[model samples]
Target: MRLRVQGLPTAAGVTRVLSLLAVVAAVGLLPWLSGRDPALTVLRARSAEQEPTKEALDAVRSDLGLDAGPLDLLGSWAADLLHGDLGTSWVSGTDVLPSVVSGLQVSLALMGAAFALALLLAAALVAPVLVRGRRSAGAFAAMLAAVPEFLLATVALLVCGVWLGWLPTSGWQGPAYMVLPALALGVPAGGLLGRLVADALPAVLDERWVELWRGAGVSRARISAAALKRVLPQLVPQFGMAAVGLTGGAVAVETVFAVPGIGRTALGAAKSQDLPLLQGAVLALLLLGLVMGAVAAFTRRRLLGPALRDASLALPAARPVRTHPAIPLTLLTVLAVAIGWGLLRDPYTVNTAARLAAPSFSHPLGTDGLGRDVIARLGHGAAPTVGTAAAVCALSLLVALILGFLPGVAAGAADIANALPPVIVGILVAAAAGPGTGGAALAVALISWPPLAAHAAALVQEVRASAFLTAQRAIGASPSWILTRHVLPSVAAPVARHALLRLPGIALALASLGFLGLGAQPPAPEWGLLLDESRAYVERAPWAALAPAVALALLAGLAVSGAAYAQGRRVPRTGGAGSTGSTGKKKEALVEV
Candidate 1:
């Protein structure tokens, strides 16, 4: 075993070392690369009141360690990081570690609560599909993922926070205060889990052992349990991925809810261009993601064990396949009807007088800045915003899928494409397209490509080695047929999971662009546009800014929950046939087929 391990050609050790180095470099450089100017700006802003005397300026600089030369600063920064000191915040003129640590607790609380809720919600929502064979579950998950998290958060804040007065507008006052924000975060994540579980189940169902179980007269519940158990081992890694992705949404949510979390702090710092704060926040986030990923990988290696080893060694033979029943489609129909009804009725109608006024009952969702009906505007806005996202995701996924498959089919090009940095692509595309719908779309497409490409490449590799794909190829199946029937179907589960996982981040990016005056134009009724408009009112009518900010956060949460639910639903399990089967037999069957 030792000889074989040593003789293996894989560069896992090198990869691990490189990954660590990359992380270190990234964390170290952020303060210098993206933070210096901001730190200086804040220092200068502080020093302005004291006159631009050299002593005052020097004092401020010295206080921030800016008095040191760049190399010395970098060295100092490295040394501090090595000792777990995040350095002092230039903006706050305080030690960075305590603030970061304090903020981290809040963020983690929000994230953890949201994640737990999302998982529970997803399990309940997807259970019907698993037990009852309903396809609507999948569509509902898709639609949920389609809705932007910012938008969802807005609706929740208005309906739940304002109208119903069930929750406070902002602030983490107590445990109750966390509920709305957590739910807002959890809904989209749960939805993603549902979609993933839904998609992954079909693959497990198609496995030959499942047929054997069925032949043994296993009840549907028993079959589902078995399938779920088998798939759970694989599903854990996805949970980590979801957590990583949700970090961004969590930030937005925490900000909207006035949670005083790291995310909120980061946003404040970013707006003022507080370099050290921004760098610290971003580095912390990156570190969180890396840690989650590493943990997931380690867990997977530990749990799967020999099965993984065997999978890497010998490919199994193909067997007849069976399609699981479609998810409950009727649920989607009902949801659509509800959404339509909600749109038609006076969603904002407060009282009898308001309902009966001249301009009353004018619009269900009310009116915006241009005297346009809010309901009508939302209806109109939905198509463009949501539709653009769908288009962007599709385009991005298509590009990624093509790139991913090319390596399997044409090796060299795939290598080159994979080697290219997505950020470079994004910059190039953004530059060429310029700001507008076209530019926004191009940016989203480019930014979304990397993850999709990675997933697709892995899926392609898996499909290439799968028994079904190989069997089809051996039987002289056309390349297209092999791709469509064998490869594509096999990859669908992961692709759907990937798409849902990416949606919130992509929407946030789009929102950021809009906030930067690059995506939606003025008076467009977009969340980003609202944020831009409300910026001047930050101190006075802070609610103006708060409203949109909260909305963005909620929308992000919904996207995360939706994605999490979908992903969870797709995960496979393992268990009994007809509620009675030997543990060894079940385990063997799960492993064998």
Candidate 2:
């Protein structure tokens, strides 16, 4: 019997087209939904010093054709798009195409460099697992993955640019300026993609054919290549995800390094409320995302061809390893203690006389430029940052569980949704609802579901193909019984665990949104807001920034170590040191979710 591919090419194609239309409609509706006067915004953007007056605003509105309704404007933009026109920038009055194209060139170059770095890092992590059968590298990779792009970029800027002066800190001047940003964007993405690759390696290696190749004396290089091929089809989606990640991550990285990329341009456009330019930037990113998703889907189809139905013939079971959770637990304890200790002080209390003070017995983490206790802010900030992250994770899990069962819908939707990263989503949400912690949380939740959904869909497919389920079906077990007894239990646990691991990254994304001024406003004690507030004063009172920064890093590290312990692999104890005989049992955990 043939297994029908989920949402065959035609259905997926239609889904993508609809997704594009939906995004266009949303962009067109922004002005109306936001309830902001486009004419006044344009006037201010063009001449910030100019005061808004009825006559001037009306003249500007008449000149720009803002008198038309949103639908009418959308129709005009669509018509122009068909004619290879992308409309004009509201701020600069230049054709949007040229500016967008220029930004894309720089962004693509940065993304390419970042992709290369990611590949290198992935290879570094995967090579040891494939060649030496060592799984310890996974824990390190997890740590690498947990570091947020913004934090990493800031560190790179400080060390490479300021302290060592080894590379340019900010600009798109030359390749020298690209290094830090590329590393910032690539490292976490590499760690993420690499761990996934490592997770898939076990099942591929456990195949009987792998043993046959070894028995036949196939060279190690040849065998490794074959193993990779077996896993590549499954990994294509992840590769697409990594591509989206790099694209979205470029926003923060570019801002830090001051690269003239589309992301930065879009961010600037949003801040200045340049509707046309903002629309163009989002459109370009959407197209890039769809194109990348298409490429991944096409590649997966080609790799599988028509011969590979029921791909999960044998779902490899991973024996859990003994892991001590003490370290992760300890790290978390320290953070909790710090926050608890900080709660005793008034975060709002300002001591102007002690502004930017260094750490002292009176002030544990010193004072901010505004003279607010860093410890109190750090303590108070935990609720918004961590709580929202937790909420986002929970909502994402629910959506993932629901969408996971609908494989076709999930696959197509993942492609569309993955394009809009948290920052991009925040841009849209901020435009619509106004920037605040609530909107930022909503934005994070919107983009956070796709990964979990994809994971659920894959697991659903695998569990449905399992022999036990097939046997039950043959024996006349009802569909609901099989689903409830076998499917949900199998899919839910792994997906929830995956969501648990993602908690820190989610928090980081929220912080990033805040840092970009799309989240909690100043004086709210949001971690990202605090980072933003202290950045200018970083050179003077490094302690103010360092407090929150250290808290974030510790949070990430705790997640990594905790995940490592939770999913620890069982290593063979009795195998001879040089022996490859135990290689077949050396599979990484099956769930890299």
Candidate 3:
């Protein structure tokens, strides 16, 4: 939470910037690494069957800088970059600079609308703090955060466009068409911000400063303002991270709404595997996120000013975990049954007779372009998608437990792992594993564990230092017994909760890779890969795309619900004010486990 001098690069910040730069550089080389002749792919994209003559190939290699050394290519691109040339599109044979410029405007506009709506929604959540609805607000946010923006766009389309006939479903019409999409994007974004706000606020209000204000006969309104002022700086990072991820999330959102923003451009580039366009778009998004983050951080600090200072007084400790409904468990149960059923059937069998049919009695989810059952593929995909997610969460929980006992190494490794965005991790994993569902699963599972591991490790370390654990050690309890019986059982819920919370992230990573044709290849029927296959025939068969998206969102909801359920459990509170801790002295009772 420490803010260095304005524009100073902390070791972590520098590592992040370098990581992104490396990703962009590595991304540029992907077309060459694909094992396809870069020249042939470029030529074929432009012509139906351009004869792959040696002379023609050689000319292409020269024109596209394919034959140049990496440093030479970098120098060439750098020179071009100075002159405002982002190179030409491999497929379209047009300058990329103009496209990037125009696309940035569109993305900014779309993002602005989304942010405005998100801010309003966030403001409304603050009301619950004054009232007595903290638990209810948390539940609401958990529900919203569980659902992805794509599904939200789908629901908006169904209601505003189809059901009410009040808005257009698929276009970049004027602001009218923009409203639903903005809402679709913003609500979930805001839900997360609300959760962060709520989580941070109780601790702020519990600060000894607030008690001092009360003792000094300060007005309640002033004390509340003071609490919010202090909490606002903590929010800066979350807000920026959310915005950066939202830019990436926009790929799905824009695709669903048919908005002509950078997302759709990136989606097209991904599907076409157009190297220059994809690289340009990826670089743009990455740079956009990094730059926007820096700007947002500066702005937050400048605005907060003195409020950014750390308090000498101990803040309110964490709140007591509350109880909630079992909706998540019930929902996950239903989803598990569906996936289990899918595991029993093969979705790849071609049924040409029902080719391209709409949803009907026999084909519950309808048929795809090749007459394969969509439901079958979706069902079959469940074992990989959901099952992979489950495996990841379980693995993360296990790793965190083992590593939690070794804080120094765990914290440093987690910090490094968490610094790299999931997209970078996914792409690297995909490249290493090659193209298959199993590879995709492994890539996702590997990338998805870090943040959860970091959080879990921090919490676990706190648990390990408690009085109960010390007492257990003195009671002739072996380390093995303490970890297996005492530690694992106690920390399991929190770890489970973190894992469940990561489902949307897993879903997003899967879809991004799937869109790039790097996910489960033909007949595997993964939702993301389904979306990829269906994009071409969207006009002919919209349901093909819609079904998988809805299913993915539904599953995400179930996962979040499961997390909420885990969070709501009445667990034994093991540590509080009496415990000597990591951060500082604990004046207030804040339960650790």
lDDT by residue for model 2 over 85-191, one digit each (tens)? 87888888899999999999999999999989998999999999789877666667767888888888877777677778899888888878889999999999899
Off by over 4 Å in 3: 1-14, 45-49, 132-134, 203-223, 303-317, 320-325, 344-346, 352-375, 390-450, 456-497, 500-504, 515-518, 531-550, 573-593
Tens-digit lDDT track of model 1 for 95-182 = 7778777888888888889889878977876787687656566555645544444455655666687668887868987998988888
Ranking by lDDT: 2, 3, 1
lDDT of each: 0.57, 0.81, 0.66
User: TM-score of each candidate?
Assistant: 0.63, 0.87, 0.79
Q: Compute the lDDT of residue 501 as modeled in candidate 3.
A: 65
Clashes of 1: 77
What tens digits encode model 3's per-residue C-alpha lDDT throughout 1-593?
85569887555456545655666567656665554566887778788678989998899889888788767776676677667667788788887777777777777898899988888887788667744536466556656765667657766776677668887877776888788888888998888887667766776776677788889999877777777777777567668877876776676677777787776676566556565666676667767776776776686767566654443333354554454456656666766665665556668788787778998877766788998877778778776666666666677667766765665555444433433444444544444345666666666665455555555555666667777788888879899887777666655655565565665567657665665566667766777788778766765676877777777766766665655455455344434433324331221122211
Query: How far out, in Å, is residue 122 in model 1?
Result: 1.7
Top-lDDT candidate index: 2
Lowest summed lDDT over 10 consecutive residues: which window, candidate 3? 584-593
